[model samples]
Target: MLLNCDLGESFGAWKMGLDEQVMPHIDLANVACGFHAGDPDVLAHTLSLVKQHQVTLGAHPSYPDKQGFGRRSMQMSEQSLTNTLHYQIAALEGMANVQQLSVSYVKPHGALYNDMMNNPQLLKWVLQAVARYSRSLKVMILATAEQDKHRELAHKIGIDLMFEAFADRLYTDEGLLTPRSQPNSVHNKQALLQQVSQFHDDNSVTTNTGKRLPLVADTLCVHGDNEASIMLIQDIKQLLNT
Candidate 1:
């Protein structure tokens, strides 16, 4: 499976993630928009690094919650949410255009991503924004028990969909991501490897409840913000290679 990671989170003065060390290992780069943790300079630098490594570029739009690092969900009107999504993608497009690069896919970040999976109304708004921006933008979505629900909706909207499986997070028996605030939200190296190992053999994940949940993965995600992310990615590459 192709590997992906969130990058471009380092804002001015404050720093986060092992982007430089991890970029070479990832196949997709989800660059953060300014509303979250990236500035124009950081975005430019991140896009450049990902391009240098020949990784596919993807835009990561989030709820306008930089202070909460986009992890906090917001209740917004349909119009406002649609506009916010369009705004973030356009911002990344503007920077990418300058570098002779173009984003090929879209992935919501933090609460926005979680909301898309849980709230169908919010997902429709997000998809509307993506289609309005460009029908060609493929959308990245989490692969869960409700995978067919997304496929049906995305098919109806005529937007291409890519399913992603998490490499470092715990899953619930229902195939939903366990809340990050809960314990064992992020897996240790051995746990992470054990989870991904199933992806190759059966396209499945071992849930926190010890159930095997089937999933289809177009790409595998590793969180760059974790202290163990670099090492985790290294093992992921090694495992995939084997």
Candidate 2:
């Protein structure tokens, strides 16, 4: 399993994740674009760290909601949403190009990511945006235990989709991630290790309801905002390697 983290989320004076320490431990870095919490300087610095660590770079795009931190959902037309996605991704890709690095994957941030998974129309537009950027750029989405509508749409769109499982997020009874607003949405260290161990054993995640939800995924994500997650990321790496 490939370990990944959201990076470059820090805005001007406000620093977010510990990209310096976290980049060295993960296989993929989902660098945030300017829309959510990243500025030009932050993106450049983050890219440098990613390049130094030789980690794979991915575009982390979100709605044009910086104040909300891209966590709140918005009502948007399909064309507008498509344009927003393309623009944010292109911004990151453009920066990466100048630095002699290329973005290999695309992952939507917060609400946009959640919207795409549940709304087929929105997912199509997002996929369309991805195809517009690069046919080969793989889009990352949450992996479900059972049926994944997003996967089917991505296959039809002809762009590769990479399924992702979270180490810190809580899962619902239906194998979907519980809404972050709910209590216990974030996992404790013990629960996290248990989930990772299960995935490391086979590609399955134990849901909150105590069911072994089968999750076939390509990458594992740990939010970089948590300072304690650095240790969790290391522990997960150790578990996976062992």
Candidate 3:
């Protein structure tokens, strides 16, 4: 499976993920588009890095909540959300054009992601925004048992979907990711690798209740927020390679 990470999240004096270290290891980068955490310089640098590593580029748009890092959901009308998405995606597309790098997909970051998956109207709004922006660009979203339903919706909207599974987060029995606020929602390094291993070996993940859930996905999502996470990503890369 292709490995993807959320990158280009640093803003001004504050830095986020170790993009320099992680860029080489990942195959696809969901770059922040100045809404949640990235600035114009960050997007340019990240596009350069992705080009350097020959990695695919994706726009990681979020609600305009940098303080919460886009983890807090906000109430937004369909028109407003679509307008915001167009603004962010177009901004990144414009910047990437200068580097001759094309953003191949759209991946909503943080709460926008979670919220869209649970709300059908919101998901349609996101798909419509992407369709309006570019029919060639696919929408990356969580992989679940009901993915066929989502695929149908996207097909009706004249766009495609790329389902992704998380490598370091726990899953629920309902095929959703466990909420981050819950205890043990995030896995340790050993457990994280084991989860990825299970995904690679069986096309399944053991849920929090110890039930195996089938998760067919095109790509796997991994993090590079720290030294340990970077090591985990490298190990995951090696594992997938083998």
Which candidate's lDDT is highest? 3
Model 2: residues with Cα > 4 Å off, grouped in runs: 146-148
Error of 1 at 89 (Å): 0.6
Candidate 3 accuracy as lDDT: 0.92
The list of candidate 1 runs beyond 4 A from truth reads none
In candidate 3, what are the lDDT values of residues 76-158, reduced to their tens digit? 99889999999999999999999998989999999999999888889999999899985479999999978889999999989
Give per-residue CA lDDT, model 1, range 78-164, as digits (tens).
888888888998899889988888999999999899987888888888887787785489999889898898889888888888999
- Name the candidate, 1 or 2, with the larger TM-score value: 1
Give, for candidate 1, the lowest lDDT window spanning 10 residues: 223-232
Candidate number of the best TM-score: 3
What value does the lDDT take at residue 163 in candidate 3? 91
Candidate 3: the clashing residue pairs are none
Off-target runs (Cα >4 Å) in candidate 3 are none
Worst 10 residues of 3 by lDDT: 128-137
Q: Whose TM-score is higher: candidate 1's or candidate 3's?
A: 3
Give Cα distance to truth, residue 135, candidate 2, Å: 4.7
